[model samples]
Target: MSAPNSLKDVYLDEMKDLWSANDQMTRAVKQLGEKVSDPKLKQMLEHSVGGIEKHTGVLKQLIEAAGGQAEPEHCKGMEGLVTEALKHGIKEASSDGKLQDVAIIAQYQRMSHYGLAGFGSAAAYAKVLGMSDAETKLKQAVSEIYKGDEYASKLAEAVEQAAA
Candidate 1:
């Protein structure tokens, strides 16, 4: 996308970038889910795929609502995070189930945090532009992401304790 001359452009661009980010994250989460030994971790990852898809839909809606094409511009930031997730959570993952679970949660949270930042920023932009509907949806997505991140943190703690 070209440089944004207005807040609307930035907001739309953020939504488009989030679309690509969600798509990339969905694939990575699925791959991570398949590799996880912990049933709880696996379940969370599976559930998150659906959540990510829903958020992707919201992003599409927001982009179109703002009179922008829903087409996603590839997010280089998410691309890097996904690469790191695969490398650490899968490629160099430990043989120990508990250790691998820790790595997976860490990777998942890293990606989720990026989403939180993007979605939160988009929501702020929407609020500044007086688009209450857009702001509400974006904020909702951020809240959901935060919930997942919190769950992952708790799960990580449980896994670490179990390994001790």
Candidate 2:
């Protein structure tokens, strides 16, 4: 078997990937805020945009603490995924308030799931790297995003189901 990378290298690489994804989402959320007609969805997007910016700052601090560069390598994967989501939302556009809200919630939750997974992994890496404060902060971030996704889904489901 090929030799595995050193633990520090592995952790740093994961942070880089997460940083790239965050960079992509940071811009994507703003564009997304404009795409959805629902006021609530727009607010959620705005809130998430702020949270992502905060997460990016924490990531930068963590990377620098690890002796790695704080700069991000752009994540084309998240960019394409978000772009496609926007396109799909547009193509399937509707005036029905409930349907539009459902679409926005689904897309937002999907993105949140991505963030939760990435952040959770990063937290584990930070813990392994002996970064106690970074681990705690990342853990909190992952939990908060997961809760937001659940709350949004519940609100959207209530609207969709009521309309149905």
- Pick by TM-score: which candidate is best? 1
Best by lDDT: 1
Per-residue accuracy of model 1 over 3-109 as CA lDDT, tens digit each: 99999999999899999999999999999998998899999999999999999999998898899997999999999999999999999999998899899999999
Error of 2 at 164 (Å): 2.5
Candidate 1 contains a number of clashing pairs equal to: 0
The reply for model 1, stretches above 4 Å from the true place, is none
Worst 10 residues of 1 by lDDT: 61-70
lDDT of 2 by residue, 60-107 (tens): 888898888777766566777677667655557567766766776777
In model 1, what is the error at residue 67, expressed in angstroms?
A: 0.2
Candidate 2: clashing pairs of residues = none
Could you tell me how far off, in angstroms, the CA of residue 111 lies in candidate 2 after the best superposition?
Answer: 1.4
